[model samples]
Target: MSSPVAMIPYTNMAPYRQLGAPRDCRFVPVVPRVSIGALLSGEVVAAAVPVGGLKALEGVVETVGRFGIAAEGECMSVLFFSCVPFEEMHFPRTIRVTGESASSVRLLYLLLGSIHGFNRLPHIAADGRVFDGELLIGDRALVKGQATAGEERHFITDLSQKWFDIHRLPFVFARWVVRKDAPGPIKSAISDWLDEFKAREASLVEQAVPEAARTLNLPPAAIRRYFQVIRRSLGERDVLGQQLFIRQFEERGRSLLFQPAP
Candidate 1:
């Protein structure tokens, strides 16, 4: 029987997930956080876990390929929307995040606290109308970005763009990982399957555009442009960005992650 490999169902991951997997490994479509959980709990053999979520899974999973969801300056989906200026807003949403990704929420806290010197981070109520700021990722964020285009009421910030401005590296949101304890053959198969996935992505992405357009509820052109923004193959700079984000995750975000000022 083939091993199960997580396929994150996100617009940014349209290339990999839209295309069917190899015979040796089947694609299990799930969101990023769930993929991580499934991998750790032995539900799946491998997955593309978010970079921010990798801190706790240190030696449990092995990093597969350098390829993943990354971008140099702007990733259109992972956006932070604030009604007022960062300093003026009573508290831009931090803890409450789009369930699609927790790493995005963590990254927001890191940027806010580390660079902007914010101390107290507030948790947004589930399903509450966001008054301060809201962090949205994946397809929902892309939809929000499209809806707010040309509007100035919401202060929209691209997390990847912000990271690039601060660090000059491509922010790696997630990377491929496989079970370390899985038999050697399974590990090798996942790696080989990833390489094949990368090589075929360009054609697959084009094929996926129409489905993505309908699914994401965005114009085809917008979907096409977004694919250009999200780079699947990770380079050296992307690796550096992941390192910085993970390294600074705790050091700079200690205030928000650990104890919040009341």
Candidate 2:
């Protein structure tokens, strides 16, 4: 029989690679967007899907494990860099966002529409050069953020921090999701993989730094700090945070985007 296939994001591969690939599964590296599509298409039995993309999966997929990417506060990689101060960014609702993770895109919308009180959905700029505000995620966000520090007009806003400031809960970025009707063998394999990952969590972080630095083209120290700010394990509070996010998104009439897994 062929090994079950799993799609994992390039940005989130550090820890998984550190622990070595699962013997019973084929691990494929893909971006968050591709991962979601692959899962929906049945090309992969499981994927690490961005939280924002969950709504799209609706009744099709369900979370397989408690592990995911999250942040307690100030996730360094999911950032907003703007020419104007965050409070002053009112007149033009449009902003340029990196065409990467869907979760980051949704998070940006949630913040702008709910917290910032924008009357209209923000316009997403296709060209990066035309916007005063830009949303960046994953490795690109980290790299661009470093470059923006020297620019006096650029102001950085950490989205996770913004969410925490208001809700006091961690923001979950991605989670392991699989087709709801997947066979028992595939589900068992994924559960075992998560168990192995939890067992070597510390080593995963230590080994991930150098690899992540290479993949992100940032210094190892910087990658280390980024990892420190991220929470790979989901706790009770993290679950609450995700529920709050979904409830808030629904409240804003954007609930049609995702369906919670049964």
Please tell me which predicted candidate would have the highest TM-score against the true structure.
1
State the local distance difference test value for candidate 1: 0.77
Model 1 residue 178 CA deviation (Å) reads: 0.4
Candidate 2 per-residue C-alpha lDDT over 95-158 given as tens digits, one digit per residue, 9 for 90 to 100: 7766677778778778876655745444555543476687888777888887777688789999
Give the alpha-carbon lDDT of every model. 0.77, 0.76
| Model 2 spans with C-alpha error above 4 angstroms | 4-6, 120-122, 126-129, 254-262
lDDT at 141 for candidate 1? Answer: 84
- For all predicted structures, in order, the TM-scores are 0.89, 0.88
Q: 6 in model 2: Cα distance from truth in Å?
A: 4.3
For candidate 1, the per-residue lDDT at 191 reads 80
- For model 1, the run of ten residues with the poorest summed lDDT: 253-262
State the lDDT at 123 in candidate 1: 50
Off by over 4 Å in 1: 87-95, 120-130, 255-262
